[model samples]
Target: MSPLKSYLDLYKHLPQTNCKKCGMAACLAFAAAAMRGQKLLSACPDLAPQVREELARELGQAADPQEELTRAMAPLKARVAAVDLAAKAGQLGCTHNGKRLVLKCLGKDFTVDPDGSLASQCHVNAWLAEPMLNYVSLGQGKDPLGRWKLLRELPGGEDWHRLFGQRCEKPLQKVIDEHRDLMEWVIDIFGAQAVEEEGSAELRVVLWPLPKLPLLIRYWPPEDGMESTLNLCFDATATDNLPIESIYTLGVGLVTMLEKIALTHDT
Candidate 1:
């Protein structure tokens, strides 16, 4: 069967209530959108994990904006110098995997909605310090980002033995240490400039897919009569399929919004 026909067949199995919650009327509609490379797998709330995984695999095999960015910039983790970043920050553009990108982010600003009505979601940020040294025994497929790394490290490290003389065992101590270390690294990697404003605060964070573009995130209070905006700025050459720091950006952005909300409410 043709690729589009295959996807439509899968969609036929999906619950097609046309809920519109998934941004489409029915599963077939979503499948078409997916074929067109326009919608994300996450958009379908009704999809089970297995289904989602299947779709993601299929999508990865297909052309995508993210893949396009990846080819232009090379994996999201490839580092770029400050001067390059500055030039890209002013103007960045990239294309990969059949996706086109063109934009400029310099001098752009984001303001929070003054009404305090922006839809926010729950988030979690977990980090592991003193990474687990042991290889997790994966029976088959690739192990998930060092899931078993902590098991061996928990017993004793240089510092742990130094303090306890190798006699005591502290449970979950390693876990705590790892998480703290991760958070510290995160903060160091994405430090913000101090800018005080009544209704809005501006911060920038590195997003991988487009090294030339730094995401400008803002928080504003409803009382200030501003709408919150997250701007992804890029030069004309910024690439597609770049890995986004989605978790960190969204999690931290939400916290910043809450802080602003508290400040506004108090006043």
Candidate 2:
């Protein structure tokens, strides 16, 4: 069987229902995953049996997330190569270094080479690199309006909210509940700003993962039989600065980082 060419090709075969049953926000997301071998076409129960069988035979097997991420990066990198980094520096709040565009990420300098390669004083991963490249290449670079909204409120974000809560907020809340000091440590280490909000949340901080994309994390400690809770909110213009998928990746990435830090401190 021949391999699928692109996500769009796979998308054409989907039910286009935007159902969340497959753990993805939409059929398009599932299609992308299917094409990358991260998910099987049969995962979508809505798919016709014959269609599922045909796709299963064609796709061969599902690749792990890391393998899928690596494959997805190639086209994104090519798009980045066509971008004029210098021209976008001002809009993106980056510095044009003649040969690269440098931007501050999580308080660390991340330099993007003209060829779309990334270098940072801190560790780099596909999760971070993919979003950064998307921001540099496709971001409208609109400034945050200081208005905050939940992930579901952003354009095309409704379908993704549940998965975001499951993969990002819930896990981070567990870490914060276990290590309360981790919040302050993240603020100090990542150059995040502590903010006051009228709520039960014991701690709140805003992290600028991208110049125009600010994420606010609020943690409410358990009290009076209530369990601890955490919620991640974003600027209303966040979708303009990064796609919904990239935003989800960013949240998951941040949570993963915090989990590592908490583990290290515990040891």
| Top-lDDT candidate index | 2
Model 1: runs farther than 4 Å from truth?
Answer: 1-7, 17-29, 33-45, 49-187, 198-212, 220-267
TM-score of each: 0.27, 0.80
Candidates' lDDT values, in order? Answer: 0.32, 0.83
Kindly list the per-residue Cα lDDT of model 2 for residues 1-267, writing each as its tens digit.
346678887788888988665657778889887777666565577988777777766776433445545555667778899999999999997889898999888888999988888898889965678789999999998999989999999998887888888889899999988998878888999999998867545688999888789999877889899998789999989998999878988888788888889999888
Give the candidate number with the greatest TM-score.
2
Q: Model 1 reaches what TM-score against the true structure?
A: 0.27
Deviating ranges (above 4 Å) for candidate 2 = 1-29, 32-69, 197-201
Give the Å shift of residue 48 in candidate 2.
Answer: 20
Error of 2 at 43 (Å): 12
